[model samples]
Target: MAHAYVTFRIRLARHALADFIASFKSSGEIVVLVFGQVLIGLFALIAMPPMAASALPFYQSIPLLLAHGMAMSLPLFLLRRRVLPRDVVLAMHPLPIPPRIALAADALVAGILAGPLALAYIVSAAIWMSQGPEWLQADRALPATVFSFLVTCGCSSAILHLRARGPRPGPRLRRLTTLALGEPWRGPRIAYLWHRLFWLPFWRGDNVIGHQQSALLLGAIASAVAWTMAPAGIMGGVLDLTASASLILLADRGDKAVREQLGVLRPIMAAWPLQRRALEMCARAFSLAPVALLLALLFGAGLWQHTAGHVYLTLAMLAPVLLVAIPRFNPRARVGLVVASIVILTAVGSEIWN
Candidate 1:
């Protein structure tokens, strides 16, 4: 039944949340971080009206862009958000009652979407699209959303089949990890690892996905600038593209990690008896630290005129959180939390200017 998918989703969400709490070893730190996330989310919610108000012109100016933007964003969930084992998929395949009903359920769950917020976002998009008006056609968002999900499902389905034929990459990734004792560590370590693993393809001159990441980053920057310069203009399309592209970048990175690292074989990395001086970490942090900073700066880039200090503080918050806390969590969980944190921070920043 559809309830099976729903049940699985709930279980996944629970596991992630618990892991999130566990990532912060100290009880006090966990409370503090959780409180910070809650406070930020609450502020974001409070500012939603104004944020929505400001974006109204853009949304109205290009409703189709909004539709497309929302639709394309769902695929980000397919990127390493969840990877269901092949055996599990085969077992659940029979539960769809009527095959057609199962088809819709599979499209909705798509197997790889493990993040709860991602699931919620995709479902919300579906509901909104179904009810949305389409001046160009009737109900543009509905069909667009469905198509988007179908594409995502295709990708997820491919991964399921591919996985059945192969092994996870976690072990390989660990082998590539350059650990050291007393290395010069600077910047956010999470950024360091993110840069190390996620950027490896780029660094090694892999063209396809690397270019996609760059193009998406450029699109997001352009969208932000266009919106700031002319919210009522045709920037909505760019924003839509930007929204999907940036999130997809995150998803793709997660996918790559899973593909390369074989995420399952090693549950916890065996730490050496001696605490490594982390010299290597410091030396290496530079590669991704700047990149992380750039992404953080983008969220509040437009707000610098009014809330420069706040914007900087927001960026400041991101560094340590990524460096320390995020790395402790599994790859999938790391990606999910980082994305959620950015979204929450962006929301909170939106209110600061208002």
Candidate 2:
């Protein structure tokens, strides 16, 4: 029976792989991935000198490289569906394969897709390192390269898992939003508060605003472990911790926003009921109102800071929220207006900031 099951799983995996490939055949996602690899390769070739100069102590540089690698991989993982929903779309079709097998196949395909880019990055890093000062050449580029790959894999895995397991916004947002707006503010205050507080860790965890609470705590613990072996700068440790925390917080916020937006459109969701939709609407409203208030506060804070960088970042972040709010003013003009605003704002912001 065990042997039979093993054979069955193999067949299922093969079947899943076939489906996965077929799904991507016409998607043009692979073309985009190839183009991106080429662009990165070109950029690396041009920027080799600066990149080499940026290298630090092996210990310090390793984490920095890993962090950068993870950051680079993150957006691709996060926006994978925008290219092709190959995994979800393929999984939806009726097949003898189990969901787990299908998921594994999807992962395998994604790994294959990422392999070229990973190779290019490694080559680029090696070339860059070779151009650095002779003393720095002693730094083990192989270990750093391996670390970067590991970071990319870890981040990609985490993002995929989160995407698979995170709360489905369509149902949750529709239900929550409907409840908040349909009923008076007094109704279910405790429930509403609980929901609000649930995402607070994610908000407070944001790195941009400098609240790296979780990352700092983890890094401090790691630093204490490292200190047992050698001395580490307290300031450097704090900054690393903060950066890690901010990265996590920012990722969480981005995912939460996407989920909430999905909820707003839940009314059009074929599988959900009116009651669920109503509740989701309530949740969406509740989530969005505070976000707007937060943006206003951020705008004020940015003005107070009087730094062009902060002002530009604040504006970049708030542009989306403002675009989201446009529907309220004129529901019919929402989509076009939002798209236009985003284009104009992004173009202007990039020109000014860059």
Candidate 3:
């Protein structure tokens, strides 16, 4: 039984490996993952100097390391279906292999893929800490680093599991309700007034405000309030709130349009591929708006603060967006044209404007 179990596990591992490789069949997928990796590497490099200057004790670097590690993990988490071996696990479910063994194999495969990125984070943290003031307790840094890494791994796995379930309407509806409750008063008159006065402009022509937009707005306001009340880290807090709010607003508008088109007219267009194409177009447009706004906001902040690094950071952040946008080109020749345009714009803006 033990030998048979081992063999089954080996097969499962191979299946998982194959699924991971299949994800990169398209040039676009390869570009997106590679770009994401490069962005993570750049962020670590850029953040190192400032972190070093803070002169935080080695032990203190732990929280910062954890924060950065989690941040780096989030993009991958959001794109887990593209990066993970989901198909393999699902395929092997009816097999003779035990569930635990199959799960262990999946974890091992995921860890292997995520290992190098995780190591890059650790190395960045170590290098940044080495340049800082001497710590009274250097030994504690190692333990803290390990703990942070574990926390990140755990969180990453949980995110993958949740994402595998795919998008559902229940959570969306619940979030919308929560956002509606965020208005000044819970009374029916107040709620109606709030909807007609404040939310009407934000609502789509269909007479309904999107749940995602409302939730995002609520989150942004909450973040801004928290940032205002916080003693330190106000600048970072404000930037986060502003960026998130902008992204939410853009997403809300984009999603509302797409939903209106798909839900109301989908039955008529059920046989048409154009509906799918339209949705994809709206999605790309929606995704890009937040990024553009983020870059502009970052540039404005950089200009005001005279921080070249922030501007450069913002440019680097666009790599993933560009990668995703590349796949939207129907013709292969258009890819070259789009790529060239992006390069020219990035160079002119980052070098000349900044």
Among all candidates shown, the one with the greatest lDDT: 3
Which residues of candidate 1, in runs, are more than 4 Å off?
1-155, 167-275, 278-284, 292-354
lDDT by residue (257-319, candidate 2, tens digit) is 534445544555557444554454454344444334433443443322435435544544564
Q: Per-residue error at 255 for model 1, in Å?
A: 18
| TM-score of decoy 3 | 0.41
Worst 10 residues of 2 by lDDT: 204-213
For model 3, what is the C-alpha lDDT against the true structure? 0.48
The numbered model that scores best in TM-score is 3
CA error at residue 42 for candidate 1, angstroms: 19
State the displacement of the C-alpha of residue 274, model 1, in Å, after optimal TM-score superposition: 11
Clashing pairs in model 3, backbone N/Cα/C closer than 3 A: none
Q: Model 3 Cα RMSD, Å?
A: 11.5
Q: How does residue 274 of candidate 3 score in lDDT?
A: 50
Whole-model Cα lDDT of every candidate shown, in order = 0.43, 0.45, 0.48
lDDT of 1 by residue, 143-243 (tens): 54344444445655444344323334465445444432234658875555545544554433212445544655566556545544445323443343343
Model 3 off-target regions past 4 Å? 1-66, 83-106, 122-142, 161-335, 346-354
Task: Give the poorly placed runs of model 2, Cα more than 4 Å off.
Answer: 1-117, 138-140, 143-287, 293-322, 328-354
Q: What TM-score do all the candidates reach, one by one?
A: 0.33, 0.36, 0.41
